[model samples]
Target: MEKNKEVSANNKVDVDSRRDFLTKTPIPELIIKLSIPTIISMLVTALYNMADTYFVGKISTQATASVGLVFSVMAIIQALGFFCGHGSGNFIARMLGAGKVKEANEMASTGFCMAMIFGIVIAVVGNIFINPLASAIGATKTSMADTKAYMSIILIGAPFMMCQFVINNQLRFQGRAVYAMVGLMCGAVFNVGLDPLLILVFDMGVRGAAIATITGQFMSFLVLLFISLRGQTIKVNIKNVRLNGFYLKEITNGGAPSLFRQGLAAAATLLLNKYAGKYGNDAAIAGMSITTRVMMMLGSAVIGFGQGYQPVCSYNYGAKLKDRVREGYFFCVKYGTIFLVFAGAICFIFAPDIIWAFRKDEEVVAVGKVALRFQACVLPCMATTVITNMMLQSMGKGIKASITSSARSGIFFIPLILILPRVFGIRGVEVTQTIADILAMGIAIPFAVSELRKMKKME
Candidate 1:
């Protein structure tokens, strides 16, 4: 009896030490420690994307616009990747929290397998219908060649991109975010270094950018695969990767919100490019591209922080610690809002300089400046909406999450994009996104409030 008591005391001490490590650490300090690495990873990614735009912009306005045209295709691929990654990561985190290590390992393997299969299918289909795909994404006669060249390489590299996402998300959920960051950072560096060499030295133009991006993705995949196999807490084994229909359903249901959100974003970009093409000049498309790249850079930082909060929220929720979930949510909103506000202000203040960094065309710069300012003004609202939606999704509130996800681009932005441009012309293009951001935030408020009240009740 005495020995049993002693063992119990020792276990208690160890558990208390762990709990102290998690809670006594300052919340903001922990968030920054987790998020800064993610931010660095995201910044590296954005830098390479910008490098692509910069190099491609130097080729011609048409070439520059072609990058925008292919963005929707990339978005679709990302939609799938995010769906698999986030869905599995959410489940894995919850499983770990519940002390179901085996289940988490199974989920990791299943998600990786699914991503690879889907990516390969997309690559085959996209390659076969390259022309149709390009046209559907708003490729103009002048932009078609560059679009095709860029997109073909991306399609072929789809499996690598998708697998990398699976590895990244799983690592993050395992509380190994630094490993995930390393993989992404390395890939971004590779892309950035290779862009100029391939595009300028090899005279490959837009295709060169695509090749560089694919190579980087492949390298990242290799690194992530190694980490997943040897270093991660979650073990992925092919033999254990069986199709449990119920688990599959759970993953898909949980992931559908991300799919809808990202898929609609891709569609919206396609429509924007198409509508801009109707203006009979590549300048409009190029301007939109520049504005989007800048906005995404800011958005990526916000998203990265939100992502940092996701695992914490999921783990606490699964553990039935409703208060911690609430705390994490509010913390995310506060940090995300402040960061976005400052970022928006900076973007607005340097709109012209930002646009001109990508291209020197007077027309592109003029159009991009207005768009950038409008987007900047809407950034804080967008950040709020993103955090709210992420909170709901990470908590496994699928239906509500899907509605929030669809609200911005699908329910509001799409119809507005189609209607406002008809009534207000090019100016409508700038205003539509700003209005959508505001409306999305407005919708998020009630949902967030209700969720908070529910958390309080649970407490």
Candidate 2:
């Protein structure tokens, strides 16, 4: 009994120490320290996603296009994951900052359970209507079989995948990005290791790729679940789970931006794929898909860095240290934009090479290069857009955050994608995303400025 009491006291000390560090650390140093692991996690996650496309690219053009089409489904899965994870995580951080540790635990527990249930529903329903679902995602006749093969396995793993994502975001919000990084990196590495063997050696084709992807997600889910159960950062227990209106409201308010952002990404991809099909052929679809993947890879780092700022923003806002939140936001935007500038320059220089590296078909390269270069040119603008949305969401400004989040994919891209191709021919399809990024940035500026002014006034 005495030993157990001593251990409990030590755990409390550790927890308090971490809270102090998070609250007291210098803004720049803290953001960097927090961001590095998250950036690695994001990059590795992106790499594994690319690995699936890359290995599938080796199969056939139809196969690659099939993978691309199914990406919309993947996007939706990711959307749900982020919605629950970010929603609960934002509240959890703030609750902790306000010294409401029990409420934070309750939020985490409720979010995880809800996400898992949601995933199960999606998986079951998706499998039931697999054929029409494939057609809805723009799968061509040739790509239909592979799309079914991939989407089925992916949907089957949805529960694990969503749950894993929830735990990961929660850990990061708790200032345990290293633990989150470890879990994600392990899964990514495992996925990469298995991809070639299953796709090539086993000759299981797209099914093999799907299996590998889900296997990684399940492993990651286990890793994260283990960490949370061990009471490392925020413990997720059934007892702490509350499914009431009060908690749900907090989660929705904090997470609505991510839902719009990622959910619209899925919707936009569906439109893009459908438009690509109309404009050209499988090659066109593959080209746009590859371009999207490359841009996402580049953007992942920025998102990860922005996420690092989220906990800081939420914590300080809850603690009423508006100055710290304001400072952290600007710090992330400046450094993130500078880094993207360099990344964009490199991508622009090697657009063709990058496209060809993924899928070596001549038509694919032709279609992808122009789009990739256009996106690279405007990539730096994403820092402002993404950070603004993240900040607004973390601060629980749901309306502004949702508007900012939906701007690029839903508000601007949807309209442009519909009208541009008719007017500008193929060039319209190629440059749609770049135009969206610019317009989204324009929308984000005022939102960011207004919030900053409010924070300043609070001083």
Candidate 3:
């Protein structure tokens, strides 16, 4: 018992101190402090994904393509988890800022419960129609068997995966980004280790990879659940769960943007695979999937930076400190753009080498290199789009937030995916992301400017 007490003490963040730190610290210092952990968390999570791709690439081209197809399903599942988490988490930040601890507490538990139920539903429904689900995710004839093998087990672990995301986001919004990082990183580390062990040593093939992924997720879920109960963070308690209408609406307002963003990403992935398969076959799917995974790692830093800004944004906005909100926004945008530009330059220089590092097949490298270079050219544009969407969501501007969130993946990418490939062939898929990102940034700039102008007028 004494040992347990000592550990809790070490982990605890004083509730009052956290509130003060978020609201009163220097914007640059505060955001950097919070962002570092989140950035590491995001990158580590991306590494977890890459491990599966890297190891499974050793199995077969068909095996790699199967993982790609099932990734779309994973995206949809992630959308659900983020919806529950961000919805409740943003609300929790605002409520805490308003000094409504009770409301934050209730929301924490309620959001956790919603994700649990939604995940269970996905698992049961997904498995029952596993074949059709596989087909819809763009699994081709050769890849279907491997896809099902990986996906069936992945679906069973849905509850744990969803709940872990909820707790991670909730902790971040509570200004406990470190705790969130620890929980997530622990799982990623565990997953990375198991990827080699289960996939190779046991020679269980794709099925082993799936097993490793879920076991890692379940471990992260456990760690997060335990941490959620520690410190001054909002406790995810069963007794506090409320399914009331008011809370639901609040969740809709805050979380709808994330849902649209991730949901549309899944939609885009499905379309990308369809067209890629049509143009190039299983190799195209594997190629595009590898590039997409690499881009995800590149974007993770910006997303993490945006996440750090969110709690500060929501809290200060709630506390009516408009200046701090404005300050944090510009501060993040400046640094995020610089970081992406530097990173994008490196990616552009090493595009072929990077793609080859993932899968050495000549065709896979050919497809991935062009696509990666195009994406790298426009990577810096993502900073504004990501930051603005996060700012709007944190401030509860759902309609605008959803619009901005949808721009890159849904609003723009969908139509481009439909039209571009017809005119340009496989090259169209390679270039679609570049065009969408630039346009998304264009839309994001004006929205962010307008909001800042409004704050100025109010001041």
Q: TM per model?
A: 0.94, 0.98, 0.96
Model 2 regions more than 4 Å off? 1-12
Residues 1-459 of candidate 1 have per-residue lDDT tens digits of 999888656645643443343344566666667677777766766776788898888888998999888878888888898888888888888877776666777899898888999999999999999999888888888888999999999999999888888888877765567888999888887898899999999999999999988888888889989888884246668976857896787678667888889899888888877777775368988998889888888888888888777777777777787887788778888878898889899999999999998999999998889989998988998777888888888899998888889888888889988988888777777677788888888888899999989999999
Q: How many backbone clashes does candidate 1 have?
A: 0
- Give candidate 1's whole-model lDDT: 0.83
Sorted on TM-score, highest at the top, how do the candidates line up? 2, 3, 1
Measure candidate 3: CA RMSD: 3.1
TM-score, cand. 2 vs. native: 0.98
Q: Write the per-residue lDDT of candidate 2 for residues 1-459, one digit (tens) a residue.
A: 999888767766766776787789999999999999999988987886799999999998888888899999999999999999999999988887877776888999999998989999999999999999999999988889999999999999999999999999999998889999999987987899899999999999999999999999989999989988996447899898899999889889988899999999999999999999888889999999999999899899999999899988888888898998999999989998999999999989999999999899999999999999999999999999999999999999999999999999999999999999989867899999999999999999999999999999998
TM value for model 3: 0.96
lDDT of 3 by residue, 128-148 (tens): 999998888888999999999
Give the alpha-carbon lDDT of every model.
0.83, 0.92, 0.91
Which candidate leads in TM-score?
A: 2
Clashes of each: 0, 0, 0
Residue pairs with backbone overlap in model 2: none
User: What TM-score would you give candidate 1 relative to the actual structure?
Assistant: 0.94
